[model samples]
Target chain A: MRGAVLHAPGDVRVEQLEDPRVVEPTDAVVRASATCVCGSDLWPYRGINEVTEPTPIGHEYCGIVEEVGSDVTTVRPGQFVIVPFIASDGTCAHCRAGYQSACAHRVGVTGAQAELLRVPHADGTLVATPEVPSAELLPSLLTLSDVMATGWFAAVAAGVQPGMTVAVVGDGAVGLLGVLSAAQLGAERIIAMSRHEPRQRLATGFGATDIVTERGDEGVARIRDLTDGVGADAVLECVGTGESMDQAIRSTRPGGGVGFVGVPHGVEITGRQLFSTMVRLHGGPAPVRRFLPDLIDRVWSGTIDPGRVFDLTLPLDQAAEGYRAMDERRAVKALLTP
Target chain B: MRGAVLHAPGDVRVEQLEDPRVVEPTDAVVRASATCVCGSDLWPYRGINEVTEPTPIGHEYCGIVEEVGSDVTTVRPGQFVIVPFIASDGTCAHCRAGYQSACAHRVGVTGAQAELLRVPHADGTLVATPEVPSAELLPSLLTLSDVMATGWFAAVAAGVQPGMTVAVVGDGAVGLLGVLSAAQLGAERIIAMSRHEPRQRLATGFGATDIVTERGDEGVARIRDLTDGVGADAVLECVGTGESMDQAIRSTRPGGGVGFVGVPHGVEITGRQLFSTMVRLHGGPAPVRRFLPDLIDRVWSGTIDPGRVFDLTLPLDQAAEGYRAMDERRAVKALLTP
Candidate 1:
């Protein structure tokens, strides 16, 4: 098998690796149909996160099951499925409560940017589609593995309701999909914060009612102006920086909510500010397993096409190009066909 | 008129003050029937919070309306009413959305421990009872002004539901009342965390199914053990310290909720911690005015006896002794009569 490995910062290489096999009774091997470079992947590539050793790196993938262990029941060979990044036992209390990321016995699936990958807790982590999907449906189906589901989680956590005016802070893939999720959830209006023309267009395509290009305090003022000085009813913080978090909180109405899905970095929130605003705060590494089935169904039905977030594509042997394109801002996301 | 003033930390005196009158069209003057020393008041009385000047102190009161300005409508002269500690206009966007504490025009009534108080936003901040109550009902009625209402807000914010297990982190007056509030809200099992004998007895009397005397890590471990290793479904954080906040978060199951109503001091929360927990955090100063009507009715009907939290009674001239008793933990609460 061939896979992408990081030997050092900014040094990703496509190299030959041993094929994965079902080592545990609950494990299964999946042949990668499509995978992508995640924004989080850039953290290590930029030397901000440590890469202690050469390691196989991707956690998002959707593909056909190649083999299943004796204990597997729900999915079988030749079936297409979406894999939640965090694998879990479906019977755990946290999993039962729709928070699989915090499941009592959980495993993280990595090395997905390869021709084949082994998945633990197969029966619990993989959601099989009704049938094999067409080639054109692969990108959208692949997104259900992480980014799209995370965006959907943010919208749900924010309490996006019918007739709500929602504001999304961040112009990345997650933010764009958040606009789509809010639209599907029946938000009356969506304010997308972005200065880039292309991302703004993508946001509008995803049903953003308005776009505010300003950043920080000026951006908050713009949202307030648009909402008649009342601020948004729900705000999605898709960037983990201190400034974005502050802007998101300040742009929400006094009794509104802020659902943040960004992996927070260098952000500190004082209890006084949170208490005075009375805004509900909910976020985390998304429990993608909980929302997988429904999201896959939506993608299969063409209700939303989140695959548009993938602006670049490459062959499995050229995986390094995928990372470089995303790192240089030349691509919103890069899809790799294995 | 006479009121309590803080000459310095640990120095409270009953002194002559100018009589209060309805100065604004939206104001009203009330002759206080009962005012009490609060757990929050002890912050300054103990010298932990600075007392830069001889400030008039107390924020909770229930009284008879003696005069009303021309614009006052809902509450009139000669009516018995519960005046929430924070006065709000009741018509602002926040007030309309059930967050009166964040109302655009809000005033904190700090001189309630006096013979008379001039309350602004009279029509919005005061909830008039159906009729004047007997002396025996005054204590409970006065509680509707702050502590009881604040406790009820904690329970509601924590999302307490029938058949759910709830845990309270503090055992102060508000914490005791929180137990009562959770019981009223239909929580099947209530766990009160306290070491004091009297407070534990009161908690059990208020419907606490279990009492854990442990604090911090051990306390969280005990709660998890009691909940089948999943932690409580809802945790009310009544103390604002970092340790209390951390315990409250760790004691909640993933996807659970925490309602913290303590006046936050020196509490700092990192976004990473909050994001990783996936716990819903809702809290702040209680919007007592929003719950005043229902709580007043509950007290009037004898359905609840929150006033039992006040274990000491003092005449207006002995206000210093009232503060001293609370500061020394000799009394759970001090009720004053003019």
Candidate 2:
């Protein structure tokens, strides 16, 4: 099997690796159909996070289940499925409470940028669609495994409602998808904060009612101006830097909500500002499994085409080019076919 | 008229001040029958907050309406009423959404600890009782003006549910009242974190199912141990400090909600920790006006006695003693009569 591996910071390669097998009773072997480079992948690729050795490097994919362990029940061999990045035992108390990301028995599926990947807790982690989706819908359904579901979680956490104003602070695939999620949730106005032309176009296509090409304080000011000087009813922070968090906080109306989905770097929220502004903060690793089933359906039905984010594509052997394109900001998202 | 004035930090006195008069067409002047010192008042008196000049102090009171401006239609002269600390016009979109504290035309009622106080937006800010209450119930009903209502907001914001566990971080009058609020909201397990004997007794009387005297990490450990290592379903943070904020965050279950009511001081929330934990943070100034009607009824019916928090009482002229006792930690709360 061939997979993308990171040997060190700034060193990524697609090379032959040992094929994955179902090592546990609840595991399933997935033959990857399509995978993509994530914004989060840039963290280790850019040397911001330490890479000790050659490690499997992908967590998003839509694939066909090639094999399943004895305990797997919901998904069977040969079924096309969307696998949530976080695998959970779905019956755990946390999973029952709709927090599958924090499931008591959870495993993270890494190295999906490969020909085959092992998925743990298969019954709870994989959402099987009625059939194998068309090639055109494959990329979008793949996104439902992570980015799209994450965007949906951000919108849900922020409590986006009909006739409400929502601001999204990050221009990546997840942030662009957030506009779609907010629209689906009935938000009347969706503000996309971005300066990139491709991302701006994608955001608009995904139902952004407005766009502010500013950053930080300037961006917040623009949102407030658009909201009649009262900031947005809900803000989705998809970039995890201090500036992004600050903009998200400042862009929210008093008594509003800020839902953050970005893996934070060094941001911190002051108590005084948090209480004085009276904004509710809710976010974290999204419960992607909770939305996988419905999102896959939406993608299959052509209700949403999140694959539009993939402006670049390559074969699995050229995974390095996919990562480089995203890292250099040359593409919104890069799709890799294994 | 006489009012409690803070000449500077540590110097509170009952002194003559100009009699309050209606300044807005929708304003109403009320003659205070009773006013109480709030836990927040001691922030300046204890030198935590700098007092620049003779600031009119206090924000909790129950009184008889002395006069109503021409535009005041809901509340009238001769009516007994409880004034919410925040005066909202009740007509703004925010107020219509039940967030009266963030009302578009909201104003703070200063000098509530006075013989007479001018309340702005009287129609929406003051809730009148059916009849004048007896002397014994006056103290409890007066609490509905701020602390009691604030505590109720904490419980509501935390989404305390029947059979769920709740942890309160502060043991002040508001925190003690938070226990009662949680009980009223049907939280089955209310854990009040307190080291002081008096506060512990008060918390237990207010329906605290357990008490933990440890602070910070130790307190979090105790809470986790009690909840079988999962932490509380809801946490009410009534103390606004870095330590209290950390404790609240650490004590909540993943995906649980933390409702903070304390005016934040130097606390900060890291985006990474918040996202990883999947906790929901919600709070701000209590929309006390929204809960005034029901709280007044609860007090009048003797279903709740928030006045039990007032361990000490003095005449209006002895305002200095009231401040000193609270500042020195001798009393949880102090009541004053004119």
Candidate 3:
């Protein structure tokens, strides 16, 4: 199998690797149908997050199961399934609480940017579609593996409700989908903070009622100005940087909630600010597994089209190009097909 | 009039002060019947929180309205009322959202240890009882002005539910009443984290089913050990120090919440820990006014007795000794009478 491996900063290659097989009774071998480059992947690719060795990348995937372990009963061979970024045993206290990201026996699903990948805790981690999805629906179904589910988690955690104003910080795929998620949750108004024209257009297409081309304090002021100086009812922090997190908290009303789903990097919050501002803070690695079933239904019913986020697509052999496109801001996301 | 003035650390004095009068049209002059030294007061008294000038010390009070400005309508002269530590205009967005402590037109009610207090935003800040209350009910009613209300806010923000195991991470007046608030909110098992025997007794009387005598990591471990190693469903952070905040966060389950109401001091939260832990954090200066109506009803109906937290009493002129007792931990709370 050929998988994308990072040898060092700005160095990615599609190299022949040993094919994965079921190592445990709860494991399943999936032949990748679709995988993508994530914003989080850029952290290491840009040399911000240290990478000590040549590591296999990618954690999101939707594929057909080529084989299943003997003990796996819920999903069988040839079934189309969505694998969450975080694989869980499904029976742990955290998993039972719908926080599979923090499951006791959690395993991060990596190397999905390969032709074949092994997913552990198969029975608990994989959500099979009702039927084999057509190629047209594959992209949207693939998003359920992480990005779309993460965006949905941000909205839910922020307590987005009907008729409430919302603010979204960030212009990436997750941020764009957050605008969509807030719309699905019945947000009355949504302000998307974006400086790029293309991302701003995508944000608008995904249900952003307004856009503010500003950064940091200025962006927060813009959100407040739009919200009658009271701030939005809910603010989604999708960038995960200190600036984005600060903007999200400062853009929300005193009693409003801030749902942050971005993979945090170098972010530090002052206890005094959080306490004095009185905003409810809820975020972290999204329990993508918990929302997989409903999200699959939404995709199947054609109720939402999260697939539009993939502006660039590449063959498995062109994996390096996919990473470059996303890193250089040439694409919102890149879908790699094997 | 006379009030407790903090000239420096350990330098509290009962000094003559000018009488308070209704200055703003929205102000009301109240002749205090009961005033209490708070945990927050010890900050400046101990010099942890700097005091540049001779500052009037108390913020919690229950009194009879001696006079009201023309704009004060909801509360009038001769009415018996509880004045929340923070005064606010009821019409602000924050107050409308039940977060009066963050109200746009907010004012801190100070100088309550004196013979009279000028409460600004009287109509919105004062909760009048049904009628003149006897001395027996004064202590409990006075708590509604701050401590008890803060504990209730912590419980409410933590999303306490029936049959859930809750933890209170402080042994002060606020923490003791947090046990009571959790019980009133239908928490089935309440764990009060305390090492003091007397405070533990008060906690058990307030419905604490268990008491953990450890602090820091050990305290968190004890809470986890007690809750089947999964951590409590909700944790109330009634102390604002970094240690208490850390313990509260570590003692809650992955998806649980921590309602912190302590006045934060020198605390910093790393975004990585919070992001990875996935705990929901909500807290601040409590919107006491929001719970005033219901709490007053509960106190009046003998549904709760939060007044038992006041273990010491003193005449108004002996305010210095009241501060001394609380600062030295000789009293859980000190009630001052004029």
Candidate 4:
């Protein structure tokens, strides 16, 4: 099997690797239909997060099940499935509470940017589509594995309600999708903060009622102005940087909520700061597994077109280019055909 | 009129002062029926909070409206009222949204221990009881001014629900009342963390099903053991110190909530910590005004007895002794009658 590996900072290569197999009773081997480069993937690629060794990369994928272990019951071979970024037992307390990302016995899916990937806890982590979705549905379906579901979780965690004024920070795929999620949640208005014209256009298409190109203090002020100095009722922090988190918190009204889904890099919040604002804070690595079924439905029904976030595509052999495109800011997200 | 003044740290004195009169057209002068020493009062009395001058002290009070400014309509002369610690214009966006403590045009009430007190935003800051209550009901009713209401806010912000496991992390007046609040909210099991025997007894009486005397990591571990290692569904942080806040955050289950009502003193939380735990954080000064009417009914109906937290009662002239008892930890709380 051919798979992508991170050899060093700024170096990704597609090379021949040992084929994956169902090694555990709860495991399954999935033949990748589609995968993508995640923004988080850039951390190590950019020399920020440590690259300890040539590691298996990518956690997002949609695939067709090739083989299932003897203990597998919920799913079997030949079915199309969305592989959630985090694998859970489904019966754990956290999983039962709809926070599968914090599942007691959790496994992270990797090497998804390959022809075949072994998935642990298959019965609990893989959500089979109603039927084998067509090739065109792959991009959107694959996103249910992480980014899109994460955006939806941000909205849910922020407590975005109908008639709410929501603000979203960051212009990456997750933030753009957050605009879409807030819209789907019936937010009356969405203020997308972006400095790039293309991303602003995408945000608009995702149902952003307004776009503010300013950032930091100016960005918060713009949102406050738009909301009549009350700040947004809900703000989604899609970027994990300290600046983005601070902006999101400041742009929310008292008693409002800030749902932060970005993996934090250098964020530090004082208790006094949070207490003074009277804002609700809730977020983390999204429990994407919980939203896979419903999001797949939305994509299947054409209620949303999250696949549009994939502005670039590459063949499996050209996986390095996918990382380069996203790293150099040339693509919002890059879809890989396996 | 006579009011208590903090001449300096550890030096409180009841001294003669000019009578308070209706100042703002929206203000009212209340003849004090009762006021009390709050947990926060100890902060200044113990020299933790700077006291540069002889400042009027006390922010909690319940009394009869002696006079009302022309614009004061909701509360009027001769009406018995509960004055929330913070005064807010009910029409502000925050107040309308039930966050009166964050009201746009807010005022902090001071010198409530005086014979007469002037309250701004009378219509918004005061909740008049159904009628003049009997003498024995004063303590419980006075608690609606701050401690009891603050505790209720803690439980509410933590999202306590019927049948959920709740934990209260402070044995002060507010923490004891938090146990009562959790019970009133229908939590199936309430854990009170306290080392003090009297406080534990009071906590149990307030519907705490369990008591854990451990502190820090040991305390969190005990809570986890009590909840079958899942941690409490909702944890109320009634102590503001960094250690207490961290303990509260650590004791909550993933996807659970921590409602911190204690004013944070030196609390610092890194984003990585919050991201890893997936704990929801929400809190601030209690918006006591918002819960006044409902709490008053509970007090009036004998549904709750928050006044039990006050272990000492003193005449208004002995306000200094009230401060002394509380500062020395000799009394859980002190009630002062004019």
Best lDDT among the predictions, by candidate number? 4
Candidate 4 per-residue lDDT over residues A223-293, each given as its tens digit: 98999999999999999999999999999999999999999999999999989999999999999888987
Query: Ranking under lDDT, best-scoring first?
Result: 4, 3, 1, 2
Error of 1 at B131 (Å): 0.5
**Of the pair 3 and 4, which is ahead by DockQ?**
3
Q: DockQ for every model, please.
A: 0.84, 0.77, 0.89, 0.89
Worst 10 residues of 4 chain A by lDDT: A288-297
**Per-residue alpha-carbon lDDT of candidate 3 for residues B1-338, written as tens digits (9 for 90 to 100):** 88878899988887889998889899999998999899999998899988899888889999899999998889878899999999999999899999899999999987788788999999989999999999999999999999999999999988899999999999999999999999999999999999999999999999999999999999999999998899999999999999999999999998899999998897788889889888999999999999999999999999999999999999988888888898888899999998
lDDT of 4 by residue, B226-315 (tens): 988999999999999999999999999999999999989999999998998999999999999889989998999999989999899999
Q: lDDT tens string, model 2, A99-215?
A: 999888888879989999899999988999999877888888888888998899999998899998999999999999999999998999999999988788889999998989999
Candidate 3 chain A minimal-lDDT segment of 10 residues: A316-325
With candidate 3 superimposed using the best TM-score fit, by how many Å does residue B145's alpha carbon deviate from the native? 0.3
Q: Candidate 1, which segments miss by more than 4 Å at Cα? A: none
Any runs in candidate 3 off by more than 4 Å, and if so which?
A: none
Candidate 2 lDDT by residue in tens digits, B1-338: 99999988888888899998988898899999999899899889888999888899999989899999999899888999999999899988678767899888889866888899999889988999989888898889888888999999889888798989999999999899999999998999999999999999999999998999999889999999999888899999998888998999889988899999999888888887798888999888999988987888888787898889999999989988998998889989999999
DockQ score for model 4: 0.89
Residue-wise lDDT of candidate 1 within B1-338, one digit each (tens)?
A: 99999889999999999998889999999999999999999899888899899999899999999999999889889999999999999998889989999888999889889999999999989999999999999999999999999999999988899988999999999999999999999999999999999999999999999999999999999999999999899999998888888899999998888999998887788998888788888898899998987898888889999999999999988999999998888899999999
Model-by-model lDDT, in order?
Answer: 0.92, 0.90, 0.93, 0.94
Candidate 4 Cα outliers beyond 4 Å, as residue runs? none
Model 3 achieves a DockQ score of 0.89
Scanning candidate 1 chain B in windows of ten residues, the lowest lDDT window is B263-272
The per-prediction tally of clashing pairs is: 0, 1, 0, 0
